[model samples]
Target: MAGLSAMEKKLAEYKCNTNEAIQLKLVRFPEDLEDDSTTFNPEYSHQVFGDDEVAFGFKGLKILLYYNAGNLSTLFRIEYTSKVNENFDCVEADDVESKIRKIIPPGFCTSTDDFVSLLEKEVNFKPFGTLLHTYSVHNEEAGEDITYQIYQADMTCPGFRDYHERLQTFLMWFIETASFIDVDDERWNYFLVFEKYNKDGATLFATVGYMTVYNYYVYPDKTRPRVSQMLILPPFQGEGHGAQLFETVHRYYMSSPTVLDITAEDPSDNYVKLRDFVLVKLCQDLHCFLPEKLMQGFSQEMLTEAQQKLKINKQHTRRVYEILRLRATDMGDPEQSKGYRLDVKKRLIGPYKKKQRELAKMRRCLRPEELTNQLNQIDLNMQHEQLEESFQQLVSDYRRVLERLAQA
Candidate 1:
């Protein structure tokens, strides 16, 4: 720990102890197929676990899979534990049959001969995509029209459950701590975005991205919708698809009287940026956040308007004020820049200033030498340095947002 910084020293104490990886094998109808003839390499494989490297919440951890062709009958799954892997647990198809019995959907057979016969009658049927909302945009460079549609669905929808299960495979590739959810619960709602296009003279819909939100009851007729997972696949990123998806979800809830507000669970930095941009855009159109009011500084008027109109919490509302104020500010002018810095630092220094007042009271009960020791713990110089560092970082982040706003 010699020469290590305070933060680094703290991190050095933590450790990750990992053993060998678990290999789960499932051979469907092993009896019917010839020995070693039913071999397959998963077309897609995804692991679902928590941050502490444990299954933590569920009965056990799981690996969702899809075979060569993307369809319901081709899907397979497994759930086991670290003990199973560490103990070198050898499981046969018959051993795991009961665990997977309830998981298999109706009409799907575990019997190899029957399952193979069912695939022969299977048609590559595309499930009907329910249209929740739609908007049109033009390909500015190509001078053509592009129609984007957003669909909302529940777990009870037939064929949709299979579609969603397959879609979550993308999360393992994109999100760091992403885990699959229990789709059997009706509280979960899905929002899907797709591009409606014409290929080979037939209208086709290609997926762009999706978001999953859980509705939590807020007592006495109110419901708070918390966004659990959101992803705009790599191919469609940087095209403002994220913003569109967010605002569309926001608008959906805003229209409902029973909904209190929307929140995100342990949001990542990129998701925070998307939320800020979407909120700012929505708030700017309201009369309370116009240039004159924003320059006057954040007020009760601003807080009330944001909460009533958009359901944005007070903490987020304050941050939005700073962002919009920065957009309206003339940073090149020394006076304007200094004023902005002072406003932010005032909020930042509040806790430090309160600590100073508390220390004065402690002086009454302690000796002069003891009082000095306690006072020394509250370093004014360090507080000032931290305040400046925080303010500068905020300004840098605000500038980037402003640049994006200009482009938008």
Candidate 2:
């Protein structure tokens, strides 16, 4: 983002996968409302920050996307309301895609391909800039597959059932290394678990965890890929599998032909040690320097404390979101719903007004809408620490814009 020109920034998008759009529709998550009349409108949902990989919709309705990991790329899963009598393969996937579009907002994407292309255009922000859509698989530079089998991906979508056990096996292996490497579907991002299949029938070996990237709204595509998680099975530990997997993933990026800018969080010494070992030492071995950025008011000590506080706040906010989502779901009971809506309004209003004052005091120049967004973010994360994080991201972005512009 800092390296991009002011002009190039406008055309930049953080949304990856221009190969083809895989759009699905459903109701909004107790999230901001969607055009309910639209089919396949999985645009709305009712999930909290760290909840199940849930997709809420009728049978067959979903939001879908295709992603490439190494040499493998596949159309991924989506959670939705369903009662499929037969196995997933027994169902026609395209028919399900069609049905979802009819039920959610936008009345079903006119064409999945067309809609995805446009969505990529709109969601053009990322925290860091990397050539996202250009992922390639190179066996020449890739690592030898590890000798472990995985169970499942731990998601509750229909089509993935057959592969569930292996996905779970993979996760079990992952938990052996890192306690938290499961998917966070609400964000449409995941920590990948790579695997290998045996010669005859069973699973063989697996790579522990994969790092995911998110669009932090600070980059051109309104997104950035951050190393959100890591993993390595206990049995596979000390044998250097972690280093092998790390090297494999890093090698893919090294071959990116362009510097792949990435970031990760490591409040614990073990992780910092791992990052230094894999990201820095190894990248330097590749003749590349791991660029460093020091954030104000954030350090190893603060990060661990922040992690605990985030869990608490996330649960609290999840309840609020859930209640609001229930109100949206049970519209049949408006009188009962009114109280919840009013409470949300009351909870949100005061903060925006307060944020308006805070921003007014801090910076002389701000657009009304931008200020409103900042205030609303502050309102959303009302707790002290949450609000501070919200502010750090927001103000840092504001400062970056000025800095980038000055450099230009």
Candidate 3:
């Protein structure tokens, strides 16, 4: 999590890049971020890119570069500068930062570390690293709950200098999280959630998704508590307990003034899907309407793209599930329910977007008839599976009828 200065240095010095091909050329600034340059008014933020060379345009300075490695899209928050001065100063013809500074959203962290640093600085509490492991065993004879071992960290313990087990650290995080429920100052971002099982008074769950917040000034001044790998145990997977933990964590972030900026890298398909379910679906459940100013601050186009992806995934997932249920009917075993759910999740969470989004925009939007046709196709597909099962049942009945006829 470096800063703009470090990114700029990398852009200036790097040679051949990895991933996708690179292209570069100067571009006209998008309307949302432009001011008087090229005298063009547009509805949206426009961007210009090249195969080996990528150009990020702004009001004063623009970044023009060739990548040394990786796909161009894989590059995120890559350090490049066109301008940096608050004043419209351009004494240095090629001073990188001064030119592109306008393109970056205000208070956006240049690197993950920079964002975490902000979290540390804003809060007075000790930083606990992560949750490790946990398990529970039913003690039928003892008539009491038996937790095997839980690892946690207590970074804030008085005179407790030993960094010791990861368990201790995680416990500190859990207890502190509970304590912050009473806190009302503007410091806590969201009650960062972590899992811990207290067995013989030790923690097992290790902190996983190391995260931080950038006070958003997000929709309605609520902070989004982004999370990562923290888990309870296999036994807790679908019990809905995760939601309770999440509620506590988010309640802190949603307090009056704390805003959250959850930045992810070029995310995996599963990561993208999870974020959609939480940020979009669940947010909708919460009536997550942001003020125009705050909402405008977000990447509307990106979210639009995300919503589309989620719809496709959900459709495909339903298809797979329909197939599985048909098979289960033929097999006549309820045992397959567990496996079917797991497979459905994998497909639903996997990344599958591949069309050139810019060009896809050119495709005429679906008409009412076309929309109806698509639904008909899905229904037809599902109907075929259902019919197969019906046919099997028919065959079984015919056999029984034949036997009765023979007896007659």
lDDT of 3 by residue, 1-408 (tens): 578688665444432221111112111112212232322111111221213322222232322221111111111143333333332343222323432333322333454344334332322223243323233444556666543222222335342223222112222212212111112224323222323333234333322222222332447655443343333322233433333343333433334344333333344443333333333322322221233322222234334432333222333233322332333332344555444434444443342222224224434676767656555544545654654565455334433433332342
Model 2 error, position 134 (Å): 20
C-alpha displacement of 242 in model 2, angstroms?
Answer: 1.7
Pairs in steric clash, model 1: none
Q: Rank the candidates by lDDT, best first.
A: 1, 2, 3
Residue-level lDDT of model 1, residues 140-229, one tens digit each, is: 765997888887877766778876765665566467777789987788989988776553455545567899999999989999999999
Candidate 3 local lDDT, residue 147: 38
Best by TM-score: 1
Assess candidate 2 and give its lDDT: 0.35
Assess each prediction's global lDDT (C-alpha) against the native.
0.67, 0.35, 0.32
Candidate 1 is scored at a TM of: 0.67
Worst 10 residues of 2 by lDDT: 287-296
lDDT of 2 by residue, 1-408 (tens): 565575234323212221112242221111212333322211222211012223222343444532111111123344445533342233222233443333222322334354344333322211121222212222333454333321222245443323322223222212322333334444424334444433234333223344443323434443323455555533234544454444444444344322224345443444444433443233221111111211111134322322232211222222223222332334357764454344434444566667668877745677777777666765544655554565445334333433432342
